[model samples]
Target: MPLLDPARWRLLHGGEAAAVEPATGEALGTFTLAAPSDVEEAALTAARAQRAWATAPYSERAAVLRRAGDLIRRHEPEIGEWIVRESGSIRGKADFEIRTASEECYEAAALAHRPLGQVLPSTAPRLSYTSRIPAGVVGVITPFNAPLVLAARSVAPALALGNAVVLKPDPRTAVCGGHALAAVFAEAGLPEGLLRVLPGGAETGRALVEDPRVRVVSFTGSTRAGRAVGELAARHLKRAHLELGGNSAFVVLEDADLDAAMSTAAWASFFHQGQVCMTAGRHLVHSSRYDEYVERLAAKADSLTVGDPYREQVHLGPVIDRGHLDRIDELVRGSAAAGVRIAAGGRYRDLFYRPTVLADAGPGSVGASPAYGREVFGPVAPVRAFDTLDEAVALAGDSGYGLALGIVTRDTARALDLADRVPAGLVHINDQTVNDEPIAPFGGLGDSGTGSRFGGEANLDAFTETRWTTVRATPAAYPF
Candidate 1:
């Protein structure tokens, strides 16, 4: 049986919005367009089940997460297919998402065995300590670009830490992101009602945030939307962990290996059709090597193939949908109008947009180009030249976003210096910006987010609350 057999799920009746293959526009399946009432029901359900889950033995919680990881590996073929078709990811990228999601489960499993609290020194014949407790129900809102991994990163840790999750997956990727996870956890022996999959839009998300039962809201999406979610969560006094938008920079120094820099730059900007939040939106190359770098990068972009992942061997797949494709085109057109040279591609066939490179987008001209100035969530690389180290740092740090930054240089000292000067959360010395590991603290600063900082020990803080307790062997003398 298919993993997302809608009949086996608790789907609401008479809901609109069907999941479709973005490249082909074929109807894959329809998920319940969760209404506000549904969000209330899910939040209530999660709250009711959370007490027992929080009290469950550490071994039991760890076993559930380990089994979920195993089950995901066992069902890789089906899950990968769902991601490729539903989310418009290339075959290899689907595999990457599958692996990352599986790793997330494994990482979260470790959270159960870690030290939960600290023993503090006491002045008298008493003991003082701090214990961690679940934050109760957590609401997770994931976007369509990389649904499975994004959801898993938060969901797995939230569950392992003993908080129930109410997941609000993007309707465009509901099947792979929502139903697939629910099915895995169920088969892995997770208790019923601990995980609620609500696939929906802004209304559903707002409802989830507003639900009093949800103590925390973990959101991953555009910066604009993230701000709105953050505001709502704050008004309701809920902790919001936002992993938002980014216009990351890829810096290439004069002393860097040209071949390696060019290859890595292409991968950084064009990976997953550059729909990633950490996609290298700006290319900062030293003026001495700028011309050569743009030429090689544009050639590489031109050579990449774009099509339906299921049908061909393509490096890039279509954008999520037509609206996204049109937005990308508008940015590229505006960049061209602002005198940014379209060195390679600035076109598309249906939703399959060609990997594009915009050259000569310097500081003076970039202000007028939306592609360079904002987070254009598409496969458009805007290259700018910098003459000095200070200029490069200035260019990189000037953006309101500080998600990820990459510096390619043979001089380790220079690379380290640049990394220090930049305010991004993740920095790579000799590599590109689009990267993630379950063990690393993943987040950003400024408009990017309010520091989601999800992964490893950070998950403990994000999902649980700490309380101080003091004990005495005998009753202490009371002073009324």
Candidate 2:
């Protein structure tokens, strides 16, 4: 009950709670962690709500979404601060998140009027038609990093598809996420129970995913948690969307402008202190420009000031919490022990790890070693130099995870070549792959994630499914 304490907003749903400290594995805050029985009650309430919600016309549903987006835009400054404080993302990073969230909401709202399907010209005297239909209810479990963007990406699509949504935000960032979203929709005159914001941790997520009423579970986070959610959803034969981990690489070819590469790397890996799943945690450069690139990158990286997220001069911020600081430290020491040159940084202050970079991060280099294979989930990138494009691509593909990758090059053919060879879902040329607009699809492949490409027109597929009802116009022939 301690985890459920109402220290913040009364969790969107009902429950008793307690405050506890996860950092020291002791109670630091009063919070109510969801219990199984409470979860069941919430699920029942959601199911009953969906029955009424599913009947609402798409146009009417879209109105609220449009207004919600409008409200978000009007309060960008306030919402931006919420994101920065909760995620510890820098001001620029937080602004980007807000923009991404707003854009996605607009697109989702517009989708309600878009054509769904075409009527086929039939040879026989019969009518044939197909169209997208809401999945009834969708469960969205968001991550702490860029909470608003991720939440919007999931919720917008479901709402556009006309599926009622129960958004469960990350406990760490819930203060602004679910509560703010709930406010926006309420302002838009959304029907009660149509779009709810429920905030909590593991138990809350588990309950939402396992609820039979939930038709789809859209999750973005670690592979371990995704797998657990997937298994649980599978037990009920439900559909699940998982956007998992990544250790994306930024590959700078010999022809790439060193300045541009450094700029891209600095933003990609350190923008949010490298908490983004698509952040370029690994930097692989061609040997010809490798030394020059790293020097420029280190210079630029070192110049970045880490301070309060709301400060304009600050390019970096705290690493979410102290646990992350320790994790970044482990990467530094482990890689150093592996004979990696600390290169740019391997120090820290409080929960902040100095803007760090590792070089000579070969297969054996401490930070570049196998230990850093998966998503580091922080702002510590290791530089790995290669002689050929083949070698660079190989290093980028070496990890089990494949979400996104970046390539800085001047040659058109070379960029395409690398994009073709890379295993990531999204690849960027001459810029950091982490740079994205909600208009474009973003997801992952392999261990990075297991979800359909979402965003744009295709996003409707994630929230709505297709079902064909065939009626033979002609009399049944023998065995027809």
Candidate 3:
């Protein structure tokens, strides 16, 4: 089987947009962007398909998802390359994402056969039960970073639950992540028109969200965009599941092993150029080990190779675009101007920024500072020293965004205690902040998201509606 061509896909219906390579600013291909009319058409078509699909047997639905996973694994190499060129992801990271996406399909397939309802004891001489039904059409809007996996997190589960999908991926990585995914599902025997991939910008997304036929909206992007999506879904009385921006904190206690802490810190801070929502932006180290940890971490950051994403030896890749690169530079420069010590890497060559570390990044209470309060969305780690465990917990819980947090400590009891106190949705005891699995609940709290989890059994809740039923052997006599 050859790679899926974007031009031959089903949902191309508007002006063309150029897909540019972040490494060299070169055009990889031109993709058709979806218009407003296209969005509406897709939604209506999905609604019709979903009504039919929802009646299909669970075994058939699970088979389709399993086949989709098999196809993804077989084409992992080709898909991984597209991810590298289009999203500027390194070879390792791209491969990991492909594998993760494939596993998501398999996991979701299992849910199709699992129980989706319960029977309750009657209260007044009647039988009562509840059944979960599909939400009709799911609107999935994904971001450029980790597009394939993020799309699968919602799309696979929606399909398994008998819902159709209208996916609008980021214009920057449409061909590889969006178009290719639709092609795989189609080849795996999904009903025609059940899954439509619409690649476009904000207008396309808004059209999908506002469409009444689209019953559920699942979005993964920045907080600002998520807020608008949430408001629109609210007005339309549609279900909305949002996974927004994050500023995860990495706490290193006095008893932490410096070597292990350094390695985990580098991975959490610099992977995917730190564009991930769960990337660690703040490092709160105990005062006893602050200086040593900062020095070793800076050395590790300097040792990493930042170059072409296709190269096997390259550890870091370019940002998504020039505008994002400039934004990261501005944040780093502003932090420096605010007296934050730049321990290493405050420079960039084109879109490729060096892994940066800022020491003694003061309270980071202001919006202008990217250390604690703001989401950096770049490969920069800000460090702040805390003298006591209470102070460290305070620092970890300081941010308005409560997505994830990590603590490296030898004391298991203390780690559990701290995890209980932290406001983040995902907490890591002896690990980094960037951990995720297909079977775990994935979401955030507060400004980070709308508190809708999106994995394992959680998907059943997000993509289905419960219908209560009651039955009685005979009607009761009534007197007026």
On lDDT, the leading prediction is: 1
TM-score of 3: 0.98
User: Where in model 1 is the C-alpha error above 4 Å?
Assistant: 365-367, 474-479
Error of 2 at 35 (Å): 3.5
For 1-480, candidate 3 gives per-residue lDDT tens digits of 676875564336778788888998889878788999999988988888888899999999999999999999898888888899999999889888888898999999998988868999876888889999998999999999998999998999999999999999998999777987988898899998899999988999999999999999999999999999999999999989999999999999999998777889999999999999999999999999999999999999999999988765799999999899998988899888888889999999999999999998867457546554689899999988999999988889887889999999999899999889889989998889998888999999988998999999999999999999888899866796
TM-score-wise, the better of 1 and 2 is: 1
RMSD of each: 1.3, 4.0, 1.2
For all candidates, the clash counts are 0, 30, 0
Encode model 2's per-residue lDDT on 1-480: one tens digit a residue: 111223345543445443222222333234344454555665566667766666777778678778888888777777776666666777777778777777888888888887877677776666766777788888889888778888888888787777778888776777456666766666778777666666677887888887778889889889899989989998989888888988888888888877556777888888678888888878888888878877887887788887765544677777766766787787678777877787776777776667877777776433446435646777777888899878887888888788888888899788888889979888888889686677787789988888466789758778887765445757656664
Judged by lDDT relative to the true structure, which candidate is superior, 1 or 2? 1
- Candidate 2, residue 459: Cα displacement in angstroms equals 1.3
Using all chains and alpha carbons, the TM-scores for the candidates as numbered come to: 0.98, 0.90, 0.98
Residue 57 in model 1: lDDT: 97
Residue 6, candidate 3: Cα error in Å is 3.2
**Pairs of residues at least 3 apart in sequence or in different chains that clash in candidate 1:** none
